[model samples]
Target: MRGPRRLRLPRTRAGWRRLTQAVAAGCVLALLPPTWLYVTTGGRAGTVAGAPRTDVAVVFGAGLWDGEPSPYLAHRLDAAAALYRAGRIEVVLVTGDNSREDYDEPDAMRTYLVRHGVPDARIVSDYAGFDTWDSCVRAKEVFGVDRAVLISQGFHIRRAVALCRAAGVASYGVGVADRHDVTWYYGAVRELFAAGKAALDVTFEPDPRFLGPKEPGVRRALADAGRRPAAPLPRDAGR
Candidate 1:
């Protein structure tokens, strides 16, 4: 004899409508954490001029133009350099996508910082910060940074701070004021979904694309900058 008839979900028009509404509600619920993160993190992002000093300032990459930092990236580097010069942060960790041989974001960032008067010795390059998640994960797991100030545009700063914290870095942020032109519009729109993705990433605790042996780069950079490093917490502690 055939097994008991398989159960079937409602297939009528009204049933489908209910199912759709339920799915939509679930999606909204999934977004609430990130939305709350964007709200709560507002107070944490300050200006470079007023930010509290930290062992390092982690500057996330935007993009490059003709082998140089794009205007947005330049703005971030400018803020980081200003902080470094002001002695607000002991070292600068430039993290970004350098997955391709030809395209190098960390190098461009370091070069820009150096040209702006930041000492080369104080700059640490992370060649595998393929995304915000990767950068934060590697910052703790690979570079041995515990506390840091994250630098990025206002629209992107909140999520960066949250992700870095989740990845086990005690983090603050310095928001580079947006130009309020096309770039601001684009960044603001993109941040909505980026925040959601960050929430999911934190919950999942996925490993970074690359995690080599822990190195002394961050500690050495901080020492060179004349600051003793804070003892790092467990990599999975925050999450």
Candidate 2:
């Protein structure tokens, strides 16, 4: 016997309209992560504040020219340089990518800081800060820095803060005027998306490019890594 005819659902104009709206809503829902990050990060956080501060201020990597820092990188360096002069941090950890044949962001960052009056002794360049996550992890394990002042554009500082915290670095936020002068109006839109990605990087386990030998002892690898070299980063970094 033939099975009862299956009834077809209506595909009328209104039904199509409802379906389209539902899909649109789902797309919007998919954007929740970025939206949450954007909504939460406002203005800047505390500036070189009191006691909780420590030995290092990790200046994340930006652009480089052969071995020179990009203009954008210069701004971050200056901000970090200023903090160093103020005695907020005892040392500066410059971390950046050196993946290519000659592009070295960390060394460039260190040189820029030195020219700005920060001494080389006070700077340790990590030639493998593949990203904020790499820098945060290396800072805690390789550099032995338990706390740090994270300098970056205002919109990026919050995400950087979260990433550092997850990596076990007691990260604090310090804003450097964004490379873009003026508010740039709706700039928050892009920043929001960036924050979402930063949020995930916390749990994301990625290896440092040049993690050196002499990693921690068999008994206390946890404590030993805290003294590891700083990790490096890339330019136009999503952080």
Candidate 3:
């Protein structure tokens, strides 16, 4: 059999110009998703002190360290606790991975929040939040979280806010400040690619990794606080 032909570059000037145009177009196309995230989430992200008052606060899991919340995850939980203490949020929906028997992010997050002075009863756990998209979807559908203040690091808050809004949960994002460490840089770079997946999640509106029956955890938590779940608000209401 004949050997495969080697790849060739454009030979003529016109061909080179066309190739350059193609490359430029590809760069723009690749960046469009991240740009969309920033544009759509403009003015929607802020510190915990400025977070909009909402019935629920959704904290996306960062990671666990020795079955405890990692520093990054702890920061997120701390922001949520502050929101609760400031009376900006009522219920806290801690969503994270719990796929394995020993790695339980939601419970770890719940513990961290409780230790931070957030009442145990005000914390609801979503053990199936396998990713940002899953957490946002489950928050709206499974937990009936119509409106929320989403808590995550600054690098991630825009995507979180965009995904939650796409999932029909009116949201404001509380981007917890953190030192610009290696992990923070990694997370910032990672969001560029994650923005593409977020766009697909919005476009396709796929079912979460686990979409179980609607749970009354949020409602019960609200009741425990002597409050009724607020009426669902327009996605752009607080923006």
Best by TM-score: 3
Q: Write the per-residue lDDT of candidate 2 for residues 1-239, one digit (tens) a residue.
A: 99999976657999888888999998786677665554443332455443133457888886776567766677778878887677555678888888887788877787788898887767877777887777777877777766667887666677777677667766667766654544433455666666657756654656656567423321142233243443332111222
Per-model CA lDDT versus the true structure: 0.85, 0.66, 0.89
How do the residues 134-239 of candidate 3 rate in per-residue lDDT, one tens digit apiece? Answer: 9988988899987888899999999999999888888888889999999999999999899999999999989987899999999999989887445443345522
Q: Give the local distance difference test score of model 1.
A: 0.85
Per-residue C-alpha lDDT of model 1 across residues 1-239, encoded as one tens digit per residue: 88899878887999989999999999898678667787756566677776876778899999999999999999999999888788777889999988889999999999999999998999999999999999999999999987888999988888988888889887888899866998789888888778778888988989988888887887887777678544442222343
Among these predictions, the greatest lDDT belongs to 3
Candidate 2 shows a clash count of 16
Model 2 error, position 237 (Å): 25
In candidate 1, what residue range of length 10 has the lowest lDDT sum?
230-239
TM-score of 2: 0.70
Instruction: For candidate 2, give the lDDT of residue 138.
Output: 80
Q: Lowest summed lDDT over 10 consecutive residues: which window, candidate 3?
A: 230-239
- Candidate 2: worst 10 consecutive residues by lDDT? 230-239
Q: Candidate 1: which stretches are off by over 4 Å?
A: 1-33, 39-42, 228-239
Indicate the residue-level lDDT of 211 in model 1. 80
By lDDT, is 2 or 3 better? 3
